[model samples]
Target: RIDAETRRILLLELQVRPGIAALQSEQLVAKAFKTKVNMLRSLGSRVVMTVLEEVLPAAAREAFRKATSSSGAAGAGRGVRPAASTAAPEPMPVAPEEHALAARPPPAAAPPNAPQPAAAPHAE
Candidate 1:
């Protein structure tokens, strides 16, 4: 299961470097996670775009769109039109339960006052 922290980090990376082609970026991420590049890349540009659209703030999204459009246009004079600047859609709010679960810190030393369970009976 992908954790919230990991997702946040990935989103931040994507936001900071949206000029990288989605496939290349996914390959890098898959390597970092010791997974098959195709597994991640298979999710496709739409998923990556959706994640960026959801996570980045309006200004960041605008910057990303501009940068991507410019880079695509520059490549072989592709003549790609700049994506229209639009207000960023509201981020899908993380569910309260998910937020609560994510916010909880890992248990500290199994708690100081908790009773230790009896050791399992020794086998012969």
Candidate 2:
């Protein structure tokens, strides 16, 4: 009886996990669509990121970045100024030959000892 219950539970779990994942995916897609529409509405027309970067002045861009980065950290909640820490900002190392960050390899496959899905019971 316990074995049958365990199999039933596993089957239900397999079905439910996929359904939950699908619902979450749909919600994310809807959010992305809404955000894109809002961006288009605010911009007055569709504009690529590169075009905006080229058009906007460097000072304006830097000010925008600073405002965005600082707002959540310092002005979150009641808009109190956050205390500054003494730690120095870490420097990002770039590849001298490529002038860009190093590329990461794809994720490794599951280990040999990984648990695999149980086989479906025969309908007979």
Candidate 3:
């Protein structure tokens, strides 16, 4: 049978092994976290550089070019123009029937007999 002192030594050794293993596990987790944080930081820096160096300058240049090339008319600052209507233009002489209809006043609202919509409830 093992002596009491030897048994105590073995117990302590066993305890130490698990403690070392836990410490190693903690170290691994910390390393992985650090690596992930660094990778994210690098990615964020790259994205910022791409936007500031490439995308922003390109967009600014395009906007400047458009503004400079736009028409000289008043209120034409941004190179944007009002879209022209695709529908047919008004006829030179207005039709008599159409003029009469246009001159007539709009019809009145629903009669008193008609059911009215329910009013929405107000919240506090």
Candidate 4:
């Protein structure tokens, strides 16, 4: 049997828990519960997140949820789009000859007509 104390406790608990809506409800009990919840929600209780969206009519919020969930990257409830990521460009392919040349040391500058070492012949 439900008592005044039980109802009072449930109402107080509702402030911290929005899911306090009872699963087992008779017609009268449900009506009483809804009335109490509506009163509390109308006062913009911190427990009910709907207070932040009080400016929007209920239908508009539902529609936005559906629209964003299906096709848009729109963030949850904030109406913001996710940022796109940028990729680095692929490197150009290096030729074998060019690579060898680039790896070689720079030739030293010599005085005019300075004697140079003779090139060694490759063995067959």
Best model per lDDT: 1
Positional deviation of residue 108's Cα in model 4 after best superposition, in angstroms: 0.7
> Each model's TM-score?
0.29, 0.22, 0.22, 0.22
lDDT of 3 at 98: 93
- The CA lDDT of each predicted structure is 0.67, 0.57, 0.60, 0.61
Q: Write the residue-wise lDDT of candidate 1 on 49-89 in tens digits.
A: 67888999989988977876677534533332346679988
Estimate the TM-score for candidate 3: 0.22
As for candidate 4, its clashing pairs are: none
TM-score of 4: 0.22
Q: Of models 1 and 3, which has the larger lDDT?
A: 1
Q: Give a tens-digit lDDT track for model 4, residues 62-103.
A: 775576567744543342234446887789999999999999
**In terms of TM-score, which candidate is strongest?**
1
lDDT of 2 by residue, 29-105 (tens): 45555665566555532243345578889887677657645767454433223556899989987667554334555
What order do you get sorting by lDDT, best first? Answer: 1, 4, 3, 2
Q: For model 1, state the Cα shift of residue 95 in Å.
A: 52
